[model samples]
Target chain A: MPEPVLELDRLVVRYGSFTALHGLSARFAGGALGLLGPNGAGKSSLLRCILGLVRPAAGTVRVAGRDARRARSEVRRRIGYMPERDSFVPGMSGVRALAHLAEVCGFRPDDAMLRAHDVLHFVGLGEERYREVAGYSVGMRQRWKLAAALVHDPDILFLDEPTNGLDPRGRARMLTVIDRVRREHGLHLILASHLLPDVERLCDEVWVLDRGRLKMADSLERLTAAARGAKRVRTRPEAAAALAAAARAAGLVVADGAAEAELVLTRPEAEVAPAEVFALAASCGAPVLGVRPAARSLEDAFLEALEGD
Target chain B: MAFRATEYERFTGRRARRPVWWPVCTATLRRGWSSRWVRLLSFGALAVAFGFTALFYFAYQVMPNWPTLLRVLGEDEGMASGFPVQFYAGLLHVFVYPILLPLSLLFGHDLVARDLTSNALETYFSRPVSPAAYVLGRTLAYTGFLLLTTLGPMLWIWAFDAATGPQGRFGEIAFVPLALIQGLVPVALVLALFIQAVSSVTRSGVWTNLAVIVLFFFGFVAGQILYEESDRPEVVSVPAASGGRNEAEPAAAAATTPAQAPVPAEETADNGPEPTVPADAPPRIRPDRLPLALLVGAALALVGGDPTPLLLAAPTLLFSGDRQDGRPPAAASAAVGRRGPPAGAGRSADRRPAPASPEERIVVHHDPRLLAVSITEVIRGWCLGCLDRSYPEEVRRAQAGRRHRFRATEPRQVPVDLARNVLLGLGGLSLLLLFARLRRQGTVG
Candidate 1:
């Protein structure tokens, strides 16, 4: 209804003659939009476009109701950007870097210092804020980067691969921060991630990219539901054969004795009643110890989409 | 619209504060002082100057028989040595300044160029600071740096000389303060001019700097062409140098001795049977009514080095030195014009009839006062310098006659070389352009 937070219209990015992003169109509103893609799929290109750090050849980008190509400074002021690669100003203290970002965003030194401290603390950088980023670990550096991007208190955030190089626990912490920033700050977010778990937990919608094209863009629910009939049911190691046949008869795919074989489901996307699966397991001769919805997997969706294409 | 405008004006008033100039200047000064290369350059400039000064100091100390240092600087010395003030002035004009001209490149060279190269110009251009501000900020920082590097050495020399020892009554013989101030003025002028000259090429600081260096390496000739265009083409055109036009103006004066006037060592009381220079009340020199006028004239002459700059300065020196104690103006001017066999004119064997002699010279041929003034006029006005313009056919024929040893008219001539002036003029023009480019890039994005 109202103007979307971001609208990338047929954006084409070319490096010389080779187009990196070939006229891709997409729009996002005030919610977390997850961008899931393989390497070289122009996902980072999309975020750069939103930040107005890179110009598109063919189409326009409307960011926060302004044409990004024209009112770049205005648009950039409203959007916080976290680059895919490390953009740390090495040799500067983490707090200092945050302060610089705030200053660049028009904060005075006193206010910038105070805001820097707040953002550092928000990203769990508390006392380590005084430490030089040169001495920081990958996880700490990653958090510091988040603090810089957030210090400006922008309305919309563009993060390209926020969890790309983090440990599982680090990735989990980042995801929690992202969700909190969105919910508490009422900020719109774009997260580019390869790990589907991050998207499932943090995104309100998803954009699946493969080979520089938007192969799938829909609500997270519908995106997963499209692959519903092929969901696998996990069973105990002993009764894997009978479990598979019965699941096949129900138009479901069940892999035998795989990891997490203690749970069973008709489809990964189905809203299964856990207690029902728990009770029906014994009669099928594959007693289920527990049951839950199968995690949505971008890898599987990506492979299947590539095959379909 | 009225209500919104009123509110906007109030908001603007609240936020329109900017930093004061001194703090900005101090910040700029600090930036340059702290730059590693800048530290090296400033000290290097001083070390070079000190070396030149020491050579003079040592020559005075070791060879008491050697002529005073001023003669060498004044172009009167048969042998070439150095003068500290003159050497200090020259190092800047000749070496340090030409190099400093292009430093504006460090700031602006990255302009329209590096933005496209790094894909970051978008980020820079989007900042509230405009392209103009960026360029101005960069130039401020760089020129401030140059001042620190150049003047820092001079200040040290002045302080050290002032603090330390000097044996005799020339009040420690330390021209350091004058030399120091003079040292900086020319450098600042030259660098300012060069910055303006080279600024139009690119938005890049490095390229502007590089262009300056490259121009210097090949001898910047474009400005020479410009100079040729601006100057009276028929006048004697010495090669233009890039720096220190302010301090080195007196180096070529032919008549009146400069502030550092060379008194021959042989003429010293030690060797030539003392002609008493009274130690007690310091030569009872008469006060001229126009000392300030003379100083200003000296300064102008030093800047342009035209006879006007010198003649205006020389009157008092002549008035003070003309009489034994007191005399009438006409007789004094004539008495000083007398024949003492022209200083450094040559052996008796080289003598021929003096050509183009002053009417004032025949009666007062023995007086030194008239001699100095007459000679100065001849050097400034009648010394034809070039073939196309700097010298006239008369000078050429005279030069040709010097070879023959016998010629028609037997014309007495005063010779000043034209080729050297052309070389200096061209050199100066090129250096100015180089600095102009540097300044432009440093100033505006």
Candidate 2:
């Protein structure tokens, strides 16, 4: 078996008297791992600890099977970190700053420069690469930071709040770029973000942290599989309410779908049958257009994980 | 135009450790060099050095008898054979005060301060660099520019002077090259460390520059006030009340004697006929009350250099003084500040013979240590003393002969040396603290 990309053995992090991470122990082999938590939930602290920016109060953090604290330079060289806050070298153009960071990561000058250009282009910053980063807009700066993180092409990427200050369009573009990188390069990703949809789109596994403790660590498939047997019923908007009422009367669990003309029906004891959903729609005089298996939003799984502890 | 493909390709090139600090250092240098003002100032420093060299050559050629006059007066011994050590001292003084200090301030004001303000340290620390390596890279960048601006031009001037002057001039000042290193390297280190420490604390480049300027100005003013208020009889005028006896004895005595003889103010009128003081003579302006540029220009004029180089050197030395004090100007000493201090001036091992009724005597006194309060004087003194201490016996004699003009009896004093040691210790401590703070911040945050 291959070694885990990151191995945490009872890792603890504290700032003064405040403990940020309490005995975080996990092993991530290699995959897109989403870290979900609310504010002050130790998501950033875990990232920092793994990146070797913060020393563990006790236990150890290993990156690529090397002790993070002892082999900090090696660990940092192997992992690329995008900080939660806006960070860039002042007075430097986007491409030059990216190249400078690539060089600092031990890339040869020519290779670093070439990688800088390529990464900037990949992040959709090729047009504005010549502009000083200080003058870049908020979205541009975020993209530039992403380019800086990717310029050296490390084995793992720890992106802290990658979509923090981005607009909706900008956020989608960023996610697309990140998804492409993950799919094409096969790099291990540890993405910490508050946006659930973004995580659901990119990450296959999830670690939920709350108050510095790991609440749940599981594959996304297993966590969201509970709601998969439920059936979604889509009917005329005028008859959706009647269909929901009819389903509830028939001893079936009924809930609103994500849209106005959609109704979700489930059974607690058995698989929710599409025939039952269709029968309820017919009885309610609703023209049923579709009856399909429903998938639970990751938000449900994330919130449940937070409350499950 | 055809569209070019812009795609992200895998970087298959090999990566290796070539000292991570090199990128940091080169980036810093590139940023500083990109500034138009920095380029202008650097070029201006070199040009001024060239102009000064030309002026010195012209002066020597115009007044062929001046060397003989200096020898007869015992002011210097090597003027006919080689450049006097005092000339080098004066040039070093000019370089440190007018050239290097401002250039460093302009170039390094934002070195670390901006990174902290803009939160760029995260990006830097995210790489395979420790805080120590980052600080080392920054200090090296600053020190490299300092050497380029000051020491580079200094050597160029020396070579130009040697080649242009009479034959064998190079061999006469062979110790100069080594002395320059002894002098400049420490000063550069101290300045770089000090500025880096300051930059670490300040959040803005403007604030860093302001803080440094204010600290230097206040220290200089405090030193000047302390010297003026103290009762030490350090000032020695050329013409004295006691028929030149007071002048020659004390000047010679101050060369080797540590203990000083004090002459009170009232005793001068009894010894010599009181020179009449005009009631309307303009008051002597304290040098601290004058803009630093004017003082630099005045110092240049006092050295009898062409004033054209003043245009290059003056504007950059722009420390404005606060002259709110309403104290009446005293007599006979205004010229003292205008020209170089009389022989035996800064040494306290002399009675100044009461300054010949205060109106007749030119009371010239300046402690080189107190000038600018930027450690420049200490560096110059260290260079001179280093030459004396490090040279062979024969070379020492030669240096002693060349140094007869300044007559530095004991260049190193216990108190001033203690101050220098304290300053150096503080600078080193600050750098260490900066390293620790940066690491801690990076870690905890």
- The best candidate by lDDT is 2
* CA lDDT, every model vs. true structure: 0.48, 0.68
lDDT tens digits by residue: candidate 1, A1-309: 789988878888875576778778888876989888878887877776666545677898898789987786667767777766555543347887666556655666666666777777778887798897768888887787777677767777777778867898988888888888888767888888777777789887988777678887778767667345333445666766666666556555554324645423545455544554544455577855444455545556655565668
Listed in order, each prediction's TM-score against the native is: 0.49, 0.73
- Highest DockQ scorer: 2
TM-score of chain A of each: 0.78, 0.82
For candidate 1 chain B, the 10 contiguous residues with the lowest summed lDDT are: B4-13
Query: What does candidate 2's lDDT look like per residue over A144-192, in tens digits?
Result: 8888888888888899989988899999999988888888878889999
Please give the C-alpha DockQ score of model 2.
0.50
Model 1 stretches astray by more than 4 angstroms: A225-304, B1-88, B91-140, B151-445
Q: What are the per-residue Cα lDDT tens digits for candidate 2 across B334-416? A: 22222222222223343353323444434343333233243443445454444333333444355444433232213222122
| lDDT of candidate 1 over B191-257, digit per residue (tens) | 4434433443344556667765665544324323322221221221111111112111111122121
